[model samples]
Each structure stands twice: as C-alpha cells, then as structure tokens.
Target: FTNPDSTLLTKAGHHKLCHYIALTDAFPLPIDKEEVSWKCLVKGAHRNEEMINKLEALEANSTLKSRVIDYVWGAGSQLRGELIYKARVAVPSAYSLPGSVTEEELRKALNWLIQRMQLTHPDINAKVCWPVLYSFAQLTSLKACTCSEDKPWQHPIFPHLIKTQWWGRKGEAKKLGNKEDSNPFINTPITLMALVATAVRPFLVGLNIF
Candidate 1:
C-alpha cells in the first residue's frame, strides 16, 4: 500500500480500492476471464499490516520465499500479553511462487478438481464460488474477495480469501478446545486482525444499521 512517494496509503484521508490495488501492481485475471482463457494464464495460483509489510519484504527479496508469525495471543491486545489458544501462521511469498512448481502442472492436476466440483454441485455451476485457490509462491494475490453474488446470473465468484485461519473466542481459545471448561467464549474472537481489510464492515454497520 505504499504511495508513489513510498508513504503508506492509509496516511491519506481518502483512497479507493483501486488506489491501493494500484500500489500492488496487480491486474485482473479471474477464474472466468473469457477472452484469454483462465487456464492459459494461471497454470497454478495461490494478510495483515505487519503481515503485509512482511509479505512485501519477501516479494521484494528474491533470496527469501517465506516467513512465520509465531503462535501468540497478543495481536489484539494492547500489551499483547496473552498466549493461549493460537494457530501458527505462515507469511508466504504471495507475489512470488516457489521453486519446483509450474502453472501448467498445477492446472492439469487441479483440472479434475475443478471439473468434479462443477459436476457434483451443479448449483454452484452458476455461482462459481468453490475451489478456493492458495497456490505457489508466485501464484498469489495481494488482495482478493470471494463472497458470492448471492443473486443468481451475476458472476458467482467474488474474491475473498488469502490464508487458512482458525478463529475462536478468547475463553475457548484459552481452553484450547477442552470439553470440560465451564465457560467458552461465545462471540467472534479476534483470531486474525489486519490493519487493513476488516475496517469497513464495522464502519458501515454503525453508520447504516445501528
């Protein structure tokens, strides 16, 4: 999200998605792009501010391919004191795919999966929201959304995925899935947090709904 002067975009008062996307140097090549064929383009394909900074670093450096965000409970905390109920997170080289992988090979292998899902769930044939793609070092996106259109006949695939995460309330996470705990936190827990991405939902919810 660096600006033209390399200042972070969030510094500005107003910015559109296009503005941030411009920073990433990404272009559209969706699963359904018809003219060129999705298969030809994506032979294989594949989060946070500190996370974002980390990925950008990896993408910049050709020598490195991945990094790790260790198990912790402190990300949401002001002091980041807690360390219970956690999942290890990997910071992949999102823009850069790793060695020993090729797009043609991944497309051929995943073709069966794509076809099978379409055949098995004909309902999704229109929606086209299955087969979430997390791919090689090179096969990654800076940002994407994957929520469906919900209305039929519209493009079913929206881009809403990046990593695999497990979320739990603080108490349940404290318990770490133990059955005996008398109290399990019930609300949506901050299993993951980003300086970007999740801000607008709460903003709109407060402005319109509440």
Candidate 2:
C-alpha cells in the first residue's frame, strides 16, 4: 500500500517509497482502464510539480533513464523483465552477507544503493539527505580504519568487508542458466539492520538499553 503520510512527498521519502515499491513489487499494473498505470505511482508521489517537471526534463539525459522508462512502462525484453523480478525478490536477503561486515562497509554499500536510486529517480537529488548520507558513509569508513585491533575487532574471513561483501558470499555466486555468470557484486543488498546494529553496539556497552 502507498504511504498515507504526506512525508512521502518529500524527495528523500519519495526515493524511499520507490525503493519500497521495487523491493515489495507493489507497483502492479492497473486492472481497470480508468486506473492510472504503475508509472503514475512515481509521478504521484512527488509534492512539487515544478521539480517533477524539471526532473522529468533532466531524466531524458540520465544514463539510467532508458532502464527506468522500460521498468515503469513494462516495455523491457522478457529477459530484462525476468531479471528485474528476480532482483526485487532477492533484494531483502541481499542485506545479509555471509561474514561480519564493518559499519563502514555497510554504510558505503547503503550509500551506493541510495546513489543508484537517485540516479534512477533524479528528483531525489533535491533532498538534503543525499549529501548527509554520503558524508556519513565516508565518516564510517574513516572510523572503521582507525579502530584498534587489540580485541581482534576486524573479521578474519572478510577482512576487506566492503569489497568482499559487495561481491556476495564467497564461492556461492549463482550462475544464470546457459548464460555467462552474473557479477558477484550485482545482487548484494545494502541492509540497514547490520548498519544500525554495528553503529550502536559500541554505545550499548555497560548499559541495558535494549
């Protein structure tokens, strides 16, 4: 269901809603002729008409514009449609990597997803959170690098968590039928639970905040 809160109209909220739609397969084709097509879901979520117009204009030149159009209009090839469907189904699990992922790695992966989303929906660039998310990712990366290893804080299996986590579980990468193998990094989800847990764990020490 569409979010009833007016916050859905904000740029950040709009992008979040878009991601929700993708992850949940919520944008179904209209059953009745009078009902708006799935494409209008994105259009209707925007609060600012002028911004939407500007974004629509700019989207014509975006690198991901064609794919976005194809996804929205349901005009992609059979293979493309199947791939999109599979990606949506896999998104929720993509957040859970096999090994311990550092806060920095999690944040970087999340920011990468957000940036990719913004590219898919250019209107999200209007949100101030865009840069805030980027800065947070960088700060987390720096913090992770500076932490002492006296307690063996770094994960041994995936010491370079960011790179390996994005590439999926080692040696378990799935291959599509008859076709060449997919990129190991392509299906990974940037999960929020891991990021939140990692970011808050240090603060939870000696305090029963649960």
Candidate 3:
C-alpha cells in the first residue's frame, strides 16, 4: 500500500474526516475477498494504487470539490447512500454527455456509486437511503456542469449556476463540524473570492483550452 502524495492525501483526509464518519464507523466487514479489499481501502486500511488514483483525482478535480464540500456540510443529515450514488454518477457523466445524462446512464452510475458507498459505508441502508443521496449529487453536478469548456463562461446560465455551486445551501453549514468559533458564513469573504475566480476561469481558457 502506497501513501498517496501529500496533496492527494490531504484532500482524501479531508473527505474521510469531514464527510465519511458514519461510513468509517462500519468497515472491514465480513465479505468476499474483493469486497473486503475494497472495504479496507475505503476505510484507509491500506492505501494501494487505486486508492491513490481516487485520492489524486479527487484533489485535482474542481467539480468534485464543490460536491465534497456540500456533502461535508451536510454531515449526519440522515441521507441515504443511494441518493449520493446517483449524484456522484450524474456529475461526471453529465459533464461528458452532449446533453443531460440519460436515465439509463444515471441508473448505471447509481449502481456504481452504491458499490462505492458499500465499500466505504457498509452500514448505509442502501435501498432506502439512495434516493436522498442521489438528489445531492444530481444538484451538485447540474450546477457544476454549467461551466464546462463547451459552454462559454460568460453565459448567464454559467454565472448563475456557478454562484449556487460556490455558495451552496447556507442551511447545511452547521453540519461541517468546524470549530464553532471559526465557522464560515455562507458569504465568507474567501468563498466570495473563490466564486469570482471560478466564474472567471473560463475566460482564461482562451489562452489554453487544455
């Protein structure tokens, strides 16, 4: 098992620490070897290549950042894993899709996300919990995909959705578990700056689309 590079480990650690507490509580369960392996990695049992890749990708991906941030802010809000899975699949596939993602692809992604959550959060009651989780990912992805390279950043839709993506839902902030004294407001100065930067990022692509 390889320790991920610092940047990746840092992001993964933030996710594990901030968003996966309940999932962490139930791990290394009695299951087949592959499932056990998946569970181990999800629980940080042994950092292997796949784990490193996931961590690295998570760190580098701006799309994942907002969703992860939102998920963390809603900690212990009693969401079902199924819903989360739908949202996860929706984000990437939607970005890749020419149009909105199809129901079939969304379903497949939901299945994939279920497996991921099972490996990471075995205690999750999938059948009942998935819908709630799906809503989060769907909304986050919908908001994020508004500014893809194919779309002009200056488009009204891009700014509006990106703003929602940046600000997120103010009501969820209390669940983040940050030290109460330093809890961030929905309109934190830094967040506002970040929103501006993200909104303007599309203009920079004129220099290099890649």
Could you say which candidate leads in TM-score?
Answer: 3
lDDT by residue (1-210, candidate 3, tens digit) is 133443344344444433232223222222332333223334542455765677456558656644544433333222223233333433332223223445544444344333332212212221211222454464322222112234322333233333343335642344444565554433333333333333333322221223
Clashing pairs in 2: 94-189
- Give lDDT tens digits, candidate 2, residues 69-168: 3343342123234333443433334333213455544455445434333212111211112123554374322321121224332322212333332223
Report, for every candidate in turn, its global Cα lDDT versus the true structure. 0.25, 0.33, 0.35
Q: Output the number of the lDDT-best candidate.
A: 3
For each candidate, what TM-score against the reference? 0.17, 0.18, 0.20
Model 2 segments more than 4 A misplaced: 1-21, 26-45, 51-71, 75-210
lDDT of 1 at 204: 19
Q: Is candidate 1 or candidate 3 better by lDDT?
A: 3
- Per-residue lDDT over 42-89 for candidate 1, one digit per residue giving the tens place of the 0 to 100 score: 211112344345435535753432111110111223111121111111
Candidate 3 clash figure, as a count: 9
Candidate 3 structure, TM-score to reference: 0.20
